[model samples]
Target: MTRFGSRIFWCFVTAAMIFSVISAAFPTKAEAITFTPNFTISSEAAVMINLDKDVTVYEKNPNKKMYPASLTKIMTALIVLDNVEDLDNTVYEAPLVVFDELYGQGASSVGIERGEEVTVTDLMYSLLLKSACESAGILAYHVGGESISNFVDMMNEKAKEIGCTGTHFVNPHGLYDPDQYTNAADMALIAQYAVENYPKFVEIATATEYDMQPTNYHEAGWAHIYHTNSMLNRSSSYYYQYAKGIKTGTLDESGRNLITMGSRDGNNYLLVTMGSPMYDADGNAVYLHYEDHKNLYEWAFENFEYKQLLQAGIEITELQVKFGESSDFVRLVTADNYSCMWLSTVDTNRLKETINVDPSLLNDDGTVTAPVAKGQKFGTYTLTLSGEEICTVDLVAQDDVTLSALAYNFDKAKQFTSSIWFKAALIITAVLVILYIIIVAASKKKRKKYRRVKKRRKF
Candidate 1:
């Protein structure tokens, strides 16, 4: 090629490359929305999970282990409920309702007096409502058949069974034990399981006040009690109405810790934070914990929502095939459920949906196959909002229908025969055949002419 021709070819190639890059850079649609927070904290780990869909809406250093404090009681309550056959069953406190230096000298107590003879129900209230170290010890003792060490073993074993890798339990009340540690993510999982699996536990955790009359050991009366969870009380004025009872934890070493649960409309959310310095001269740690959870939850609920891109168990459309057994179409159906987030409550409609599929699904004539099976993966259904992509689900066959296999094979054969390469081969063969015929004809004519000339000469 000439120098000028080479230069022109290179320019064309560069232009093609630039065009391809630009085309790929711009998507056919936008992406999903992201939920961002307004403030930050010093806790080593935190997590917010949506219970309804079992999805983690926000997470930061969720897997690092920290002291759980009284939040460990939530797990204690859960395991006891799971193993015990009867909830209303009654039991009296063992000869122990006395405080000792080993009980963490002056720690919170349920005020259970020795020989008070409280019921199992009363112990639960004391354990959860007041963060009573004594109640925890007593309950652990009873739950494990008088062995506090055995009860702690049960706590650790249960934590592992629930898919928690970074958690261990030393005491039921979450008192500081060098070995007692749990991360925000594992705490969230434990909280999630409690709320999902046990409703009775939920009631106990959320209740603000309960009345208890002394059994045969003391006089009957009602006692006003408050939840240790700061989020539940309005007079504390956190402004989180959806806020519900989980549990809160605090210790000199563990700092301020909390596992809070709440719901707005149809969404149930869980927030877990650990290892925050509580009761600082700067502010109240419990209040700060409440603030963090409230803000994180408000941000998540405001900025995200579940948008259904496709209906469950319903067929959306079909694929087009060219020369399949059936002349015109193969059926297509949405594979599964499709839901995703929008930027905020204001932009729910901004969410968009698109489908992607294998090009081979279409025939040369751009037609679909018939008789597609139900639940077959026809394509992917993606949901996007704002400029960010949120979620993608599968589009599947909704129903089953089969077309004639022989007819599909015959149509495919026709396509193969009509291919450009096949046509070129046929053309080449025809030209060769014609050339052979012409040469034979010319040779015969030449021979005849020679014989005539020879004969004339002889005569």
Candidate 2:
């Protein structure tokens, strides 16, 4: 072949290779879709979190302060679950068990009279399902200590331990205490821990009906009992299918409060709503707590779909070393797979990836030494969508790049190739040049493909 022809042929081949590299490095932009969840509640704050991805799917004033009401029972339940070994231990409900201020109150009750004996299991049911103020008092007084104040302190300490920064427990039962408060986000986090960590707690909280059998003190046991979280039994309720165990609260000051969990197809969500009005116009009552939860769940299911954009441990690029043992380059890989939510017909072309590393990483002689261990982090590869940073992964050494002592020294000893290290660095730098060429070629091909597809459609 003629000299000019050979040069042109090599140039064409190089250009094609560069184009492929660029195309692979930069992906098209992913579309951004707006998520609108329909929710109506007078609640002061609420949040919905997707357990699997650990992302908030919906939130409204999630950080606002609201009286937790009986939802405080959730923290109580968590503390008990953490400390108690015997779920069926027995206890007596004496006059001492009743709070002087709460006994005559119209709040939900376990119907425990003075001198009533019951099991710890029964107290839990009453405290959680019935939101019985008396039951909570009994548990607090007995489990925490003789002093109810001490128990209240324990509750406060537990609240802090479980990461409820916004929560303060002045009492066990979530009766509205001016000092008692918790935010929706903190409650959701607490509820998530309960469902995810304590299996027994989850079972008890979700129970729709319980048989309150009589103990030695009360001859006839209460036959069929209902749950305080009314959403569990309401068949027409959208939350019924996904609703797990949690507590509900209602007070004139705090309004209707709920901390609920819902699981669908193995994906769980922690839903919390506080300060919702239970009564609507005309004095009719509604379960707006569950309504808010349903909207958040529906929004997550409708809008979020996960897709993998890059495979984990795939060699993305290679960098040559100026003063390495071998003239070859080192391969770079992604630390993990890229899985993200994106809209349909998203323009992936706008997706951008950049590799970053320390300038001094190359040897003083300007080359990289081999024997790089697998999983060793060299730099970071960041992927951005629409100029918004989304995923950043470490650029790891795909395999060991070991340099022979002779190769290192010869390149070092000889001033040949502008300091063997620099020469080696220049080689790695060559990879970046190759990347640039690939990107340009890939752009042309993509443009050509789009044009051809468009022209064909016209035909």
Task: Tell me, by lDDT, which candidate is best.
Answer: 2
lDDT of 2 by residue, 1-459 (tens): 234444544453443332110111222223322233544655778877767776665678878888888988877777777667787866646456455758566767877776777877888888788888887887777777666778888888877777877888888888778899889888888888788788888888888878876787666656457787766776554436667667888988988888777766666677788888878887997767677666666666565666677778988777665434444577889877777654334565767888776445655664455655567666777777666676777777777666566764554334434545445545655666677778889999999999999999999
Candidate 1's residue-wise lDDT over 1-459, tens digit each?
Answer: 234444554454443332110101111322333355657865556887777777676777887768888999988887677666665566657455334423546678756766666676777776787777776777777788777788889988899888899998988877778888888889988988888888888888878767665666656664556788766777777646888887888888887788878788788788887876666676654446677787777787776677665566555466654333434454555545655443344554665766676555544565555645556665665666555576666666554556666765565555555766455545655665567667888888998999999999999
Relative to the unseen true structure, what is the C-alpha lDDT of residue 311 in candidate 2, on a scale of 0 to 100?
A: 79
Model 1 spans with C-alpha error above 4 angstroms: 1-34, 38-44, 83-89, 95-101, 104-106, 114-116, 215-223, 264-267, 279-286, 300-304, 311-322, 325-333, 340-389, 395-459
lDDT of each: 0.69, 0.71
lDDT of prediction 2: 0.71
- The TM-score of candidate 1 is 0.67
Weakest lDDT window of 10 consecutive positions for candidate 1: 18-27
Q: Give all candidate RMSDs, comma-separated.
A: 10.7, 20.8
Each prediction's TM-score against the native?
0.67, 0.70
